[model samples]
Target: MSAKNRDNKNRWRNITVGFRVSPEENELINRAVALSGLPKQEYCYRRCLNQDVVVQGNPRVYKALKTEFATVLAELKRIEAGKGVDDELLSVIELISIILGGLKGEDANGE
Candidate 1:
């Protein structure tokens, strides 16, 4: 489907759905909504429809982890090239460094 079509499909929603629940169930629903960081209506709607609601972490942390994985793949490539695996195998220590650097509030440009 085209992006325009998808946008049009999402442009309007008119149906209203309601249900009764105990106080404990209400509290649990509210907690789930809070953790999802989505509005209560959206969270509840998605949940009722069995849609996956992903809770994403900090983008910087995600990028840092991606870089760490790439670094590991590169190290493996080196080992596959008949290079001696020395302390270089411990280079994954840099993964922590990358994660820390990203968590320090730096943007993608490190600015």
Candidate 2:
């Protein structure tokens, strides 16, 4: 048998939770997870609990940000070509802005 899982508070985490989402939602969640530099489970747990998902700067997160910037650039070019902006793209931009803002704040505080 595998070892039991416990949360930071030492609470046993045995219950399983499951949900379904559309492809668009899945893509958004995956992007957020990647950008947060946290495991998918931790990200979802924090989000569900309405707790802050603090992002720590690391190679994985930096790579995710770079890839996301490329996606945003392509989307902006499409918009310039007369295509309307999609909600998913806007959501991604908002997430990126939040992450960057937090990082900026950290830098200002020399953390």
Candidate 3:
């Protein structure tokens, strides 16, 4: 698809912008977002806007955790810029969520 065509489908288009990074940074960025399995543009857009693309949160804890995740995810954004987290962090987050009675390996919204 053309860049212009793709742009039409991006619901967050109002907030997203694109730019190029160095080849080394590009390689790293691609690798990171691949791990999270979210598209790079979407991930970058959310990070730039400081919003959670995945709105999984416990209503009771969500406001807090989502904020925390947004922050952490933002840090992850800096580390990888919409790429993804280390497996260790992913495991830890999931384990904590499961232990806290959230369904492991699934959307918090039950999707």
Candidate 4:
């Protein structure tokens, strides 16, 4: 058998939890996970438990931020003529803002 896995608290993580999400929801979750620089499972559990997903600045996170910024710029260009923005895009923007704010030693409310 493969080696067992344990969390930081030394508890065995033997339980298997699964759920289904629509394509759009999956995309959002994946994006959030990438931005948070946390493993998908950890991110999901933290979010489910209403715990904070503290972001630490690292190369992976920096790359994700760069990629997301490019995407947002493209979408903004496409919608430059006062077009309605997709809610998903707005959500991404909000997430990026929060991450950036934290990196700058600011809170979610920019304080």
| Top TM-score hit | 4
What is model 4's C-alpha RMSD? 1.4
Each model's C-alpha lDDT?
Answer: 0.59, 0.93, 0.53, 0.93
- lDDT score, residue 37, model 4? 98
Question: Judged by lDDT against the true structure, how good is candidate 3?
Answer: 0.53
List candidate 4 segments past 4 Å from native: none
Positional deviation of residue 2's Cα in model 1 after best superposition, in angstroms: 29
lDDT score for candidate 4 against the true structure: 0.93
Runs in model 2 deviating more than 4 A are 106-111
- lDDT per residue (tens digit) for residues 1-111 in model 4: 557799989999888889999999998999999999999999999999999999999999999999999999999988996877999999999999999999989965678
Residue 81 C-alpha lDDT in model 1: 95
For candidate 1, report its TM-score: 0.43
Task: Compose the digit string of candidate 1's lDDT tens values, residues 40-101.
Answer: 87778788889876544556446545665676678779889997775534534443443445
| TM-scores, each model vs. reference | 0.43, 0.91, 0.35, 0.92
The better-scoring model by lDDT among 1 and 4 is 4
Off by over 4 Å in 3: 1-16, 53-111
Indicate the worst ten consecutive residues by lDDT in candidate 2. Answer: 102-111
Q: Report residue 106 deviation for candidate 1 (angstroms).
A: 23
